[model samples]
Target: MKFLLLSILISVAAAKISTIKVTGTVLCRKQKQPGLEVVLKESDSFTPDDKLSQTTTNKDGFFEISGQDDEWGSIEPYVYIFHHCRILKEGCRTRSRYDVPQPVINGVYEMSYIDLDIAQSGETYEC
Candidate 1:
């Protein structure tokens, strides 16, 4: 019984260190907006010490960022976009919190393209 419990604990520990990968695009005014900074952060970590993972949008306004953490689904995940749309107010526009979807029998997910277009709302970076 003690050995079984130890084995279960080890399996749970291993599951928590999985990596997260998310990809999306940036669009402003119905066009691909390039040269923007995109970032991913832990949704529940108000003061998370984890290093932020970020990437710049390509010529086509696409970006991909990934990181490893055991707190994936429990903490949730969010993306931040830094663009000129909020030049007067703030440097970044944050989207609503979302959970990383789990793939078939796996912990990783391939998300659909999320568009950060300013023309749609003209407020902040609304995806």
Candidate 2:
């Protein structure tokens, strides 16, 4: 009976979910200007490995990422800021990757408001 109870407790503990709310903004490099269609990515740690969640910015250049720990139990959460530049023009069909440096996230599982300011050069082309 004790063993069965222990197993049940473990299962319950494993089911407990840790949630995080990620928010940020995108801006142009030259004047720290706000832009549209900014892309956001979540991964474990600040590195490229261990993807957790993803989201996009609104017209106000703001974005939010929310999910439970259970959703990413096998992976950690790291936030990546990016955007799609170079529309369907000559040699501009592909989207480019823009990596924000370390500490992109303010806090994990905390009610913190963070903002990301992306520069013009960070884009494949001007927005």
Candidate 3:
């Protein structure tokens, strides 16, 4: 009877789920800007994986990405962010490639409420 009870408890513990809430904004390195479209990504590592990601951002530069409960328990769940600007100039064209200048957030190992203010010019992106 003790063995059976122990097994059941272990099963229940393995099935536990938790939610992580990530929120942040994007702005210029020198200028404190707002209302920019920022792209945020969560990955098992720095590399992209089909089964490991969620992305959401708004014009105010705010973003949120919820991950699978087990994702945070892994080693260094990578987070990336980029600048998403709309091209408006007739003569000047925007760059085609998404700017993954660096890891806006990195090495996540715990449940967190994060806030990111990112800059591309070798400046630190905070959370």
- Scored against the true structure, residue 60 in model 3 reaches a CA lDDT of 51
TM-score of every model? 0.58, 0.41, 0.36
Candidate 3: tens digits of C-alpha lDDT, residues 1-127: 9999999888766664433334554444433324433333334355565233546445554555545434334322334543333323444322121222223333223312223322224433222
- Residue 42 miss distance in model 1 (angstroms): 1.2
User: Local distance difference test, per candidate?
Assistant: 0.60, 0.45, 0.39
Segments of candidate 3 deviating more than 4 angstroms:
1-18, 29-51, 69-75, 84-127
Q: What's the true lDDT of residue 42 in model 3? A: 34
Which one wins on lDDT? 1
TM-score of 1: 0.58
Q: Point to the candidate with the largest TM-score.
A: 1
Q: Order the numbered candidates by TM-score, best leading.
A: 1, 2, 3
Model 1 per-residue lDDT tens digits across residues 15-123: 5654677777666666787887777666445565454487888998888878765653443555666666434455445443334554511244444555444333323
Q: Which is the winner by TM-score between candidate 2 and candidate 3?
A: 2
Q: Arrange candidates by lDDT, descending.
A: 1, 2, 3
